[model samples]
Target chain A: MITSGDHMNWKDNLIKIAPYVAGEQPDKRDFIKLNANENPYPPAPGVIKAIEDFRGADLKKYPDANARPLMKAIAEDLGVDADNVFVGNGSDDVLALSFRAFFNSDKPIVFPDITYSFYPVWCEMLGIPYRTLPVGEDFNINAGDYNCENGGVVIANPNAPTGIGRDLSFMREILDANPGSVVISDEAYVDFGGVSALPLLREYDNLIVIRTFSKSRSMAGMRIGFAVGGDTLISALRAAKDSYNSYPLDSVAIAAGCASVADRAYFESTLKKVMATRDRLTAELRAMGFEVPDSSTNFLFAHHKSRKAADIYDFLKSRDIYVRHFRKPERISDHLRITIGTDEETDRLTAALHEYLG
Target chain B: MITSGDHMNWKDNLIKIAPYVAGEQPDKRDFIKLNANENPYPPAPGVIKAIEDFRGADLKKYPDANARPLMKAIAEDLGVDADNVFVGNGSDDVLALSFRAFFNSDKPIVFPDITYSFYPVWCEMLGIPYRTLPVGEDFNINAGDYNCENGGVVIANPNAPTGIGRDLSFMREILDANPGSVVISDEAYVDFGGVSALPLLREYDNLIVIRTFSKSRSMAGMRIGFAVGGDTLISALRAAKDSYNSYPLDSVAIAAGCASVADRAYFESTLKKVMATRDRLTAELRAMGFEVPDSSTNFLFAHHKSRKAADIYDFLKSRDIYVRHFRKPERISDHLRITIGTDEETDRLTAALHEYLG
Candidate 1:
């Protein structure tokens, strides 16, 4: 028989580590959820049709370990060869594998200090040494800062929480300087008007651009994310993934993913709608005395000069409007990262903000 | 510009590792697949209903990262508290997380020499040192052999490729001996007439019994597996999982898993049918001069007295019947591990075997 005392001895690394905390997924669905930067619209009509038409017998057998058909579809959609594509359960899964595949060394990997919170958590969990380079005052990535001695580089394009995107030339500069290390551009929000580093794959073998269906394709519930890179980089990622979990994507995900990739028209129309709503929201937030950054992604990073960000967040919550507000880095404590929702949701959010400010 | 030749360097550990090869999911579905140990019957009717009724709007937002609802359902079904359950994309995912969470130390972890092949692959990928203890001459786990100094222990109940299950008392003996370490009873095949170590969880906080929806519930393609353990162990696994991928189980999987668990009668009926077919197949193979073990899984482990296992495998493949035959572990090189499929699949396999033997 074991006792409570036996629980004290988990691995030393795990014991000292703090896990990543995702944005709140409140139980109540009545809120206008502007948190998590998720797509406000439904997935493509084809995705729904594919799910409805899925065969029950297929669930009796194991899914294709490689998910070749979905990978092929993703590759064609991204204008890459199937060999250059590697998929995972989600972009987080892909990123974790990539970190294992590429970022273990004597030197530390480098990323922006205020980038996606999960990067540092991954580094801590894997025991990979990493140094955080701070983003500029404007919350834009300074590529010059990352061209140093390091194991690798990971930059979220259209950087999360900030919604700022660096130009392709800046990405090229980093790639050229870091010829020996893998530089991953997490393009989770690139579909929302940000320029992708995918074209950089042809120029730099070290460049791996990660994308996801969660944000743009409106399939966050499905968990599909993939990486596009040179064959060698992709091969390494595949090796790491296969070693961990062979069939990461289930049949439903694969079918939904394929349908999502094939329906280019719906993807574009939805993205355009989000971008339009984002512009409108940015204007409204600015009109209300909030300094809204020019967002390339679907979210606006805004700070009210008079009101506390936390107070605004709490006030919005009271009115059932959910937006993200991070506590760390201290500098952005006064900022609220609001995801652009449907026109109605945006209107509701602005009205709530006006009432709170009044 | 990057060239194809730039593919020379990956991490040293990854470069040295060889990925696990899953059973071939042949594109052609005409052949009888008895290779990967998948369930023969379709998923529960409720599972199908869940899939058909999945809303597109739900897919727009991220799934509940912790999968609390499904965990609650699983816990209720398993007669455990929700805190005792830790769910993942599959049992493979659960095993991977458990390995990372518990098995990292100077001392080497241990497992059976001929258990699931992924165990060694995970060790190689994660740099976890593991020593393999050979099973008994009869291909059964000898608990006494495991009562030694080690970092951790992972035993697949009803050990894979050789469908023999160790009794709960024997598991208790191993647990009582290894009080300082976590003993993961991978009960992947335990539902097939094998007694689970779950009842021992009240006495042993160190015992973690893993279960899956793939085989018994006929939801392999949906990829849901979970671990039941003390709160401390479950907390550690959850921490590791959250650190890695916040949302491993997609919405479709959660819904289907809940539906499958709720349909108790369907699960029991399907398992009974497989067990019945397995008994009949074992008798037929024994009549054909094969040594068949008393299988406690949805598969049979048999060896022909005179024929080469590789030759038999090839012969069956030619006849559109697929069965697993591993080349390593020379003691079992002559053995064939065949999954208990539908009655018609069993008949076809026997007919092909008779033709080959005649």
Candidate 2:
């Protein structure tokens, strides 16, 4: 019998995973939540109607191993065939599968050190080694700095925490430099006015881009996530998914996701509201004397040397308003990651911050 | 820059993964799907109602990272603290997480040679080695055979394909023998009629039992699965889930799963109907000369050596009825996995088989 001993001793840089820390979810109610960068608005009416329309059959029956309808809708929206797309419980699920498909090399994976904290954790868990590139002094990625011989590059476009994003031109350049490596652009927050890399799918076969309905779509509770790439890349992800969990998305998720995706008008309108709110929120934070990064995503990363983010976070928590602050990675220590909520939610957050600063 | 080079150099035990083949989802028309064992009933009305209640909220919002409500409901049902349970996309997701938490070691993980095919796949993906313990000639696990020290033990109670289960006493004995390792009882089909090993939770902290909404609860379309174990074991899964995908179950899935669990009468009625259908179908198949196993699941595993499982599977498929068949693991090749369906659906399957056989 083959023992895990041989496999255990043959480790692949497993110790380096600094797991991603997300927002708190205490059972207590009445707390204002501005953590984990979730959108504060509810989903579209159509999405709700669809969920209401959801029918349960024998709970013993497995869901469509292939999320047929959900995949079809996504492909139609992306202008691709359903075969070119794969959906899962969350974009994080798809992203994890991507790590398995794209980063199974002796070389390392390159991404902004301060990017999504989940990237490194995926590397460690999948036994895939990774290399982190510190963002430039301005807290932006120096795309050229990812000069590795073997490993590909992954970047959360409009990156997380810092909330800085780059244009497609730089992404193309990054791909040009590492032609052999896979370039994955996780566009989780893309619909918030950032352009999608999906247009470039035809340009690079190694390019795999991931998108989620959580931010722009507001169906986070339904756990639907997907990826768009060359058929080969998508097939590889499909293989991993099939081997891992065939039916990751349930019926309610598929119904809601299809409804959410099809209601493009609602998606666009809600996104416009978020963008407008984000602009106002950023401006308000800046005027309050905090250094707010020009965010491309729906969330803001702000800090004030006058008051540490930790102290501000603590003060807000006392007032039932919650935001995000990280102590690790040594960079972005003063930063508080705050999600842009509704006007009312934003008001509550801004009002609470003002009191804390005072 | 740490590179994925180390992982690139890695060759997973691809050979060990006898890929799990879920039921075929044909696009032409929605036929009677008995391929993968899923509940035939829709979720309770309350489930859809809960989803509808939250439809107006933007689904783009990040889900509650901890899945507090769903976990709370699950804990209440299991009669344990919420901390003892962890919510997942499906039981498979929890099972995959278990591979990393309890079974990631140098020792060999052990399970029946012919059990859930996905078990070994998880081990292979995580680089955990395993020993395949053969079931006795009657096709059941003899717990005494697993005396060696290893990473852990995984058993799909009322094991799949065969759909036969061992009683709680045997499970307890095995848990006692493997005090140093985790013993996972995948009760995906347990709620149908199989006795739950859940009571053993008080007796053994080493035991982690997995459950799903896909069966018995009649919410396969909802894509919800959960795990209950010692708080320490649950914590390991929680840590992995946080680092991997913080919000696996979507809002609809969460709301639906909660409602399904809450609606005891609806759930019980559906299970009763499925159990009744399963019993009737089992007897009918035996009368027709198929060697049906004593099933505690919603499905039956049976076949005739002269009348091949694959041949019957194909015949049923042509007639728009589907069942699952495996090409690997020589032990069960002659067996066809048939999920008990609605009375009419079973009639259709048996009718198709009778026509094909005659």
User: What value does the lDDT take at residue A239 in candidate 1?
Assistant: 80
lDDT by residue for model 1 (A1-358), tens: 3465754454342334454456676777687888888898999999998998888667988888878889999989878899899989999999999898888677889999888888988898888999999888888778889768778889898898899877899899888767767889999999999999988788887789998999999999999999999877888888888889988999999999999999999999999999999998888889999998799998999999899999999999999999988887797888999999999999899999999989
Q: What is the TM-score of each candidate against the true structure?
A: 0.96, 0.90
Best-matching candidate per lDDT: 1
Kindly report which residue stretches of model 2 are placed more than 4 angstroms away from their true locations once superposed.
A1-22, A25-31, A58-61, A305-307, A347-358, B1-22, B27-31, B58-60, B351-358
Considering every candidate listed, which one attains the maximal TM-score?
Answer: 1
Sliding window of 10 residues with minimal summed lDDT for model 1 chain A: A8-17
User: In model 1, how large is the Cα lDDT of residue B256?
Assistant: 83
